[model samples]
Target chain A: MRKISAEKIIAVISRLCIQSNCQINEDLITSLKHARGKEQGRARMVLASILKNIKIAQREKLPVCQDTGMAIVFLEIGDKLKIDLGEFLSLSALVQEGVRRGYQSGYLRKSIVEPLSRVNTEDNTPAIIREKIVAGNRLKIKLLIKGFGAENMAKTSMLRPDAGEAGIKRFTLDSVKKAGSHPCPPMVIGIGIGGTMQKAVSLAEEALLEPVKSKRAYFRGCPGLKSKIKRLEEELLREINQLNIGPAGLGGETTALSVKIKTFPTHIAGLPVAVNISCWANRHQEIIL
Target chain B: MKTKRIFAPLTSEGIKKLETGDEVLLSGIIYTARDAAHQRMTKNLKKLPFDLKGQIIYYTGPTPPSPGKIIGSCGPTTSYRMDPYTPSLLKLGLKGTIGKGERSQEVKEAIKRYSAVYFIAFGGCGALYSQFIKKTTLIAYLDLGCESILKLEVEDFPLLVGIDACGRDIYQQQKT
Candidate 1:
C-alpha cells in the first residue's frame, strides 16, 4: 500500500483555498475576453470592469470577489492507497483544519452562519467534500470556491419520462430566463440530466469542473445518445445567450459563456435535471498526486 | 448615460434629478451592513447604534483587511436578501442604498414614498471597489464579524442608479 500523509492533504487544501480565491481561472478570463469582444455598450463595460477587477485581485493577492465562497472539495482516492493520519481522526477533520487555517490566514470572510442561532462560524470549515475510490494508486484533489450569488440561482426539476428533448430544453431555458442577471451573467451553466435528484445535482457540479473550452466526445457505438447530448448542450448555450440578460444583466448578446451537460442512467420512471450556474469568477483547480 | 458626482446624506431634490441607468461617482460616508446585521437591526430598531437619518446603507459583507490596509475585498451582496429590512430602514429617513440585483415591488414603493434612490455597484468587482473605499470603521454589531455595520469613507465610488426616487428601475427596463 502506498502511504500518504494526511497532513499533506491538509496543507494542500489550505493553499488551494487561498489560491483559488485569489487567482481567477485562465479559462474564465479568456471566455470573458471573448464575450467582451461580442458585447456592446453597458455589457462591454461590465465585462471590462470584471476583467479589470480580476487583474487587480491577482496582482495584489486578494480575492477576486468579496464572497470568497464556500470551499467545495472533490477527492478521488485510489483503493490501493492508505493514509498516514498519525493523530488525525478522519480525512474530513484534516480538510476542515486546512479550511480553518486558510480562511483565517487568507483573511477570507467567514460566511457560514448557524441556521438556528444565526451566529457566524468564524472559520469557513467543514467544507462540502465529495470523495470517491478510483482505480489508480494516485489521489487527485479538486477544489472549487463557489460564490453564492450564482449558486443561489441553481434549479432542479423532475420531468415526466415522456417529456423528451423539447421539454428538457424548455425547462433549461425557463430556468435561465427566471434567473436573468441575478446569477451574475455572463454565466457558465452546468446541466445534469438523468440520475436521482441528488445525483443529478452533483453531476451538474461535476460538469462545471470541466474546463470551459474542453471538447465533448461521442460515445463510440451510441450515436443516438451522443447526438442527443451534444445537441442539448449546443441548443441550451444558444438559447440562454439569446435571453439578453447580458453581462451584469444590463442587456446584450453575450449572456452565457458556455453550457456544459453531464448525464447518467436513472430510474425508469424519473427524469431529473439540475442546472448549476457559475459566475465569471469560475474558480476551480485540480491536483493529482 | 449622464455621469454625476454626489456625496452621502443625499437630499431628496438631488435624488429626484437622478434617473435609472445614470452613472454616478459617489463620495463621502456610507454605512455597510449585510444579512446578520440587518436581521438584528430590524428586530431591535430602536437600539440601532448609528442614526439612519439622511444616511445610505450599503448591502455588503467585506473580507477582513490585510495588515496596513483600510479594508479587504469590499463589494455588494445580493440586495433581495435585505428587502424585508429595507422598508423599515427607509421609514427612518434613510435616503439612499447601494447594492446589486433587483428589489421587490414593496421596496420600490418605499423608494418612491420615502424619496430614496437605490444604486448598484458592480457585483463581483470587490477588489476594484476596495480601491474606492478610503477608510472603514466598525460602527455596530462587531460580534457579527464581516456582517457588522461599518462606517466607510469613500471617494469616487462608481455606481449605477438602479432605481430612482420616481420608481423608475433600470433592472425592470432591461428585463422588459
Candidate 2:
C-alpha cells in the first residue's frame, strides 16, 4: 500500500483553492481569445473587457469573480493508496479541513451556509467531494470553484426512451434560451447523458473539468460510439452559440464557448440528461500525487 | 448609447434621463446587499441602519480583504435571486440597484413605477470593479459574513443602464 500524509492533502487543496480562484485556466483563456475574434459590437467590447479583467486579476492574484463559489473536489484514489492523518478518521474530514484552511488562508469569501437556518459557515468548509477508487497507486484531485450564477441556471430532465437524440438537443436548446442573460453568457456547457438522474448530474459536473473541446477516450476502442458522441457535442456547441445571448447577454454571435458531454450506462427505461453551465471565468485546477 | 457621469442621491430627473444601453460612471456612496441582507432588510426595513431614500444598492458579496487593502474583489451578484424582495425595497424610495444579469418583468415594472433605474457592472470582473471602490464600511447584518450590508464610497464606477425608469430595458432589446 502507498501511504500519503493527509497534511500534504491539506496543503495541496489549500493551494489549489487559491490558484483556481485567482487564475483563469489556460484552456478557457484560449477559448475566450478565439471567441473575441468571432464576436462583434457590444459583445466584442464585452469580451475585450473580460480579457482585460483576467489580466488584472492575474497580476494582483485576486479572484476573477466576487462569488468565489462553492468548492467541489473530485478525488480519484487508487485502491492501494492510504492516508495517514491525526484527528481525521475519514477522507472526508481531511477534505473539509483542507477546504477550511484554504478558504480562510486564501482570503476567499465564506459562501457555504446552513441551508434552512441561513447561517454562514465562515470557512467555506464541507466541500462537495466525489471520490472514486481506480487501479493505480497514484491519487488525482480536481478542484472546481462553481460560482452560483451559472450553477443556478443548471437544468436536468429524465427523458423517455423514445425522446432520443433530437429530444435531448431540443431540451438543451430550450434551457439556453430560457437562461438567456442570467447565467453569464458566453457559457461553457457541461452535459451528462444517460445513467440515473443523480448519476447524470454528477457526470455533468465532472465533465466541466475536462479541457474545452477535448474528447473522452473511454469509448476510443469503439470508434463508432466515440465518433457519434463527438458529433453530438459539436452540434450542441454550434446550436448554443447561435442563441446570440453574447457576453453578459448583450447580444452577439458567440453565446457559448464549448459544450462537453459525458455519458454513462442507464436502465433500459430511463434516459436522464443534465446540463451544468459554467460562466466564461471557468475556474478549476488539478493536483496529482 | 453614450457614457454618462452621475453622482448618487439620484434625482427623479436624473433617473428619467438614463436609458437602456447607456454607459455610466457612477460616483458617491452606494450600499451593498446580497441574498441574506436583502431578505433581512425586506423583512425588517425599519431595522436598517441606513436610509433607503434615494440610495443605490449594489448586489454584491465580496471576498474578504487581503491585508492592507481597503476592500477585496467586489462585484455584482445575479439580480434575479433578489427579485422577490426588490419591489418592496423600490417602494421604499431606493433610487437604483447595480447588479449583473436581467431583472424579472416585475422588477422592470417596479423600476418604472418607482422611477428607479437598474445598472449592471461587468459580470465576473470583480477585481477590475474593486479598483473603483474608495472605501467600504460594514453597515449591518454582521453575522451574515460576506452577505452583510456594506456601505461603499466609489468614484467612476463603470456600469450599463440595463433598465431605465421610462421602462426601457437593454436585456429585452437584446432578445429581439
Candidate 3:
C-alpha cells in the first residue's frame, strides 16, 4: 500500500490554492484567444482586457479576480492507497487547514460568510469537498475556485421525462438569456441531466472540472448514450453562443465558450436538469499522487 | 472607439456629458464598499464613515495585497445587490458608483432623479484594475477585512458608462 501523510496533502493543497488562483489554465487561455479572434466591437475589447488581467495576475502572483471564491476540493482516492490522518479527524479537516493556510499566505480574499449572520469567516475555510474511491493505487486532488457571480446564475428544473433534449435546450437558453451579462460571459456552461435534483446539481458541477475542450469520454455509459450527450453538448454550445450575450454581456456571438453535459439514469417520472455557469476566469487545478 | 477621460468626485456637469456605451478612463479618488459595508452603511446612514456627496463608490472586495503592492486584485462585483441601498446613497449626493452588471429599474430611475451615473469596470479583470489603483487607505469597518470601506486613489482606471445621468442604460440597450 502507498502511504501518504496528511501533512503532505495539506502542504500540496496549500500550494495548489495559491497556484490555481494565479495561473490561467492554458486551455482556457487558448479558448479566450480564439473567442477574441471571432469577437468585434465592445465584446472584443472585453476579451482583450480579460487576457491582459490574466497576464498581470500570473506575473505578479496575484489572484485573477478579486472574488477569490469558495474553494472546492475534489478527491479521488485509490482503494489500495493508505492515508496517514495524523492528528486530523478526517481528510476534510486537513484539506480545510490547507485552504485556510493558502488563502492567508497567498493574500487571496476570504469570501465565505455566515448565511444568516453574514459574518465573514475571515479565513476562507470550510471548503466544499467531494471524494470518491477508485480501483487504482493513485490519489488525485482537484480544486475549483468557484466565484459566486456565475454561481448565483445557476438554475435547476425537474422536467417531465417527455421534455427530453429539446426541453433541456430551451431551459438552458432561457436561463442564459435571463442571466444576460451578470455571470460574466463568455461562460462555461455545465449541464447535468437525468438524476435526482441534488445528484443533477452535483453532476453539473463535476462536469465543470473538465477542461473546456475536454473529450466527453470520462463518464461511464454506453456508446449510444455517450454520443447523444456529446451531440447535446455541441448543440447547446452553438445555441447559447447565438444568444448574443457575448463577452461581459455587451453583445457578440461568443456568449458561451463551452457547454458540457453529464448525465445519469433517472426515475421514469422525473428528468432533473441543472445548469452551472462559470465565468471566464474558470479557475481550477489538479494533482495526482 | 475614442475613450473619454474623467476624474472622480464627479460633478453634475461632468456626469451629464457621459452617455451609455461611452468608454471612459477614470482617475482620482473613489471609495470601495461591498456587500458587508453596504449593509452597515445603509443600516446606519447617518453614521457613515465617509461623506457621500460627490463621491463615487466602487462595489468591490479586493484580495489582500502581496508585500510591496498598494492593493491586490481588485475589480467590480455585481451591482444589482446594491440596488436597494443605492437610491438612498444617490439621494445623499453620491455622484456615481462603479461595478459590473445591470441595475434594477428603480436604481436606473434613481440615477436620473439624482443626476448621477453608474460606471462599469470590466468584471473579473481585477489584476488589470489593481494596476490603476495607486493607493488604498482603509476608511471604515476594519472588522470586515476585504469588505472594509477604502479610499482608493486610482489613475486612468478603465470603465464604461453602464447607466448615464440621462437614464440611458447600456445593459438595456444591448438586450436583443
Candidate 4:
C-alpha cells in the first residue's frame, strides 16, 4: 500500500482551492469563444463582454466571475493506496481552511450557511466531497466551484422506457427555457442519462467536469453504451442551442455553450435523465497525483 | 414605449415615465440590500438604522473588493429570492427595486398598489454595474458578513423596468 501524509493532501488541495477559485478553465473559454461566434446581436455582444471580463479576471487572478461557487470536490482513490481516514479529514479540514483564507485573503464573499436559518458560516469551509474507489494506486482530486445561478436551475426526470431521445431533448430544452435568464448564460449543459434517477444526476455532475465539446464529453466516454450515446448527445446539443434562447435569453441566438451527455445502464423500465448546468464562468480545476 | 431616469426617493413623475421595455439610465443615490438585509430592515422599518422610505434598493450583496477597489463585481442577485421581504418594504413606500429576473405575483401587485417599479439591471453584468457605483459605504448588518447593507452612490446606472406600477409586467407584456 502506498502511504501518504495528511499534510501533503491538505497542502495540495489548499493550493488548488486558492488557484481554482479564480481561474476559468481554458477549454471552457475556448468553447465560449466558439459559441460567441455563432451568437447573434445582443447575445453575441454580451458573450463578448463576458469573455473579455473572464480574461481580465484571469490576468488579475480575481475569482473568474463572482458567485465564487459551492466547492464540490471529487476524489478518486486507488484501493492500493492506504491512508488513515482520520488523517484524510484532517487534511480535508483545510479545504474550508483554504477557502476561508482564499476568500478573506482576496476579499471574496463567505458563502456557506446554515441551510434553513440561512446564517453565514463566516468562513467558507466544510467543502463537499464525493469519494470513489478505483483500480490504481494514484490519488486524483478535482474541484468544481459550482455557482448557485446554475445549481438552482438543475433538473432531473425519470423517463418512461418509451420516452426515447425525443423526450430527452424536449425535457432538456424545456429546462433551459424555463430557466430563462436565471442561470446566467451562456450555459454549459451537463446531462446525465440512464442509470437510476439519482445515479443519472450524479453522472450529470461528473459529466460537467469533462472537456467541452470533446469527442470525449463528460458522458461521451462512458464505456459499454458510449458509442450509442455519442450520437444522441450531438443531436441533443444541436437542437437545444438552436432554440435561440440566446445568451442570457435576451433573444438572439446561442443559448448553450456545449451540451455534454453522460449515461449508464439501468433497469429496463427506467430511462432517467438529469441535467447540471454551469454558468458562463464555468470555474473548475483538478489535480491528480 | 416608456423611458424614465428616476433617482432615490422616487417621485410620481419619475415613475410615470417608465415603460416595460424602455432602456433607462438611472442616477443619484440607491441603497444596496440583498435578501437577508431586506428581511432585517423590514422587520424593524420603524427602528431601522437608515430610513428606506422612497429610496431605491439594488438587490445585491457584493463581494468585498480586492486591494484598491471600492467593490468587487457588484451585480444584482436574483430578485425573486427577495419576494417575501419586498412587499412589506413597498408598503412602507420603498421607491423601487433594481435587479434581474422575474418577480413574484405578490411583488408585482405590490408594485401596482404602491406605484413602485421593478427595474432589471442585466444579470451577470457585474463589471458594468460596478462602473456606475461611484462610492460604497457599509451601512448596517456589519455582522451579517457579505450579506450586510451597503449604501452606494451611483451615477447613471442603466436598467429596464421589469414591472410597472399599473400592474403591467414587462416580462409578461413583452412575451407577446
- Candidate that would win on lDDT: 3
Question: Residue B102 deviation, candidate 1, in Å?
Answer: 0.9
Q: How should the candidates be ordered by DockQ, best one leading?
A: 3, 2, 1, 4
lDDT of 1 at B13: 73
lDDT tens readout by residue for model 4, A150-220: 79999999889899888888899899878877777777888898888889999998888878757874333
Top model by DockQ, which number? 3
- Candidate 4 residues lying further than 4 Å off, grouped into runs, are A1-8, A79-91, A217-224, B1-6, B164-170
lDDT of 3 by residue, A1-289 (tens): 8999998999999999998889889999999999999888899999999999999998888899998899999999999999999999988899999999999999999989889987889899989999999998888999999999999999999999899899999999999988888988899988888779999999899888888998754456566887778888998899988888889888899999888899888998989999999998888999998
Better of 1 and 2 by DockQ: 2
TM-score of each: 0.97, 0.97, 0.98, 0.88
lDDT of 3 by residue, B1-176 (tens): 78999998898788988999998999999999987888899898888899899999999999998899999999999888899999999998899999988899999999999999999988899998999999999979999988899999999999999999889989779874
Candidate 1 residue lDDT tens string, B2-23: 6899989798778878888999
| DockQ of all models, two decimals each | 0.80, 0.83, 0.87, 0.40
CA lDDT of every candidate: 0.87, 0.88, 0.91, 0.75
Q: Give residue A58's error in model 4 in angstroms.
A: 3.0
Error of 1 at A156 (Å): 0.9
Per-residue alpha-carbon lDDT of model 1 for A194-267, expressed as tens digits?
Answer: 88999889989988887888777223334488777777788888888888888888889888888888888878
Interface RMSD of each: 1.0, 0.9, 0.8, 2.3
- CAPRI tier of model 1: medium
